[model samples]
Target: MTRTTSALVVESAGAEPQLALVTLDSLRVNGVLVEMYVTGVCHTDLGCMEGYLPVQFPNVFGHEGAGVVLETGNGVTDL
Candidate 1:
């Protein structure tokens, strides 16, 4: 089975262009959930997307993001 996740890509803050995609994964965490509502892009996203600041590549870069609890980890009890 394949799970699709929407993520924000940080290319550069003011230089690199960011992107969003749903990638494939093998393992999953417990506290991990999906953001079903609409997520808005902000200036901070631009900075990260454009690589204006140093950021990890091919990683979710949404800090001010909004989502719901989809799955819980092994020790996660508070939903």
Candidate 2:
């Protein structure tokens, strides 16, 4: 089953970030589900958000975060 979560989303280039409900697909093989405690929008992310970099929009805002691993899918052993 999939889960619903809240995230800061950018709908298009130069658009303001907004809080939205997003879906999480079932964990795939070797996938890890993290529950983020703190997330950040770094310069690289800002570049992508500002249209300075080529990226697809309707995108979630963050690549940097600290969190606990809630679930580990099959084939994961090094965590």
Candidate 3:
């Protein structure tokens, strides 16, 4: 299968956030493979942007998300 690198990444310190369409690293999860199509912006993300919450530099900020399952891990039975 093909893989792509992408993230809603920040560039520099205190820079305006931009949509970064980047090639993603090969990542694996020990469960159902979730292929995300649309992810919603949460208040926490805004907090990171506005310097309210302390976040790591160049943070990939998106939690409330929805996606499709692509693969399953070992011992996975439910679908």
- What do the candidate models score in CA lDDT, each in turn? 0.57, 0.92, 0.70
**Please, what are the lDDT tens digits per residue for candidate 2 over residues 1-79?**
6989998899998999999999999998899999999998999999999999999989997888999999998878888
TM-score quality measure for candidate 2: 0.93
Q: What TM-score do all the candidates reach, one by one?
A: 0.53, 0.93, 0.63
Sort order, lDDT high to low? 2, 3, 1
- Stretches of candidate 1 exceeding 4 Å from the true structure: 5-21, 24-30, 59-61
Kindly give the stretch of ten consecutive residues in candidate 3 with the minimal lDDT sum: 24-33
Instruction: Judging by lDDT against the true structure, name the best candidate.
Output: 2
Question: Positional deviation of 57 in candidate 2, in angstroms?
Answer: 1.3
Q: Which of the two, 2 or 3, has more TM-score?
A: 2
Candidate 2 colliding pairs: none
* Per-residue alpha-carbon lDDT of candidate 3 for residues 1-79, written as tens digits (9 for 90 to 100): 4466567787655677777776644444456657788888788788786678887777776778889887776667677
Task: Report clash pairs, candidate 3.
Answer: 4-24, 5-22, 5-23, 5-24
TM-score between model 3 and native: 0.63
Instruction: Write model 1 residue lDDT over 11-76, tens digit each, in one string.
Output: 434434345667656335544555556566677666666767666765454455567756655766
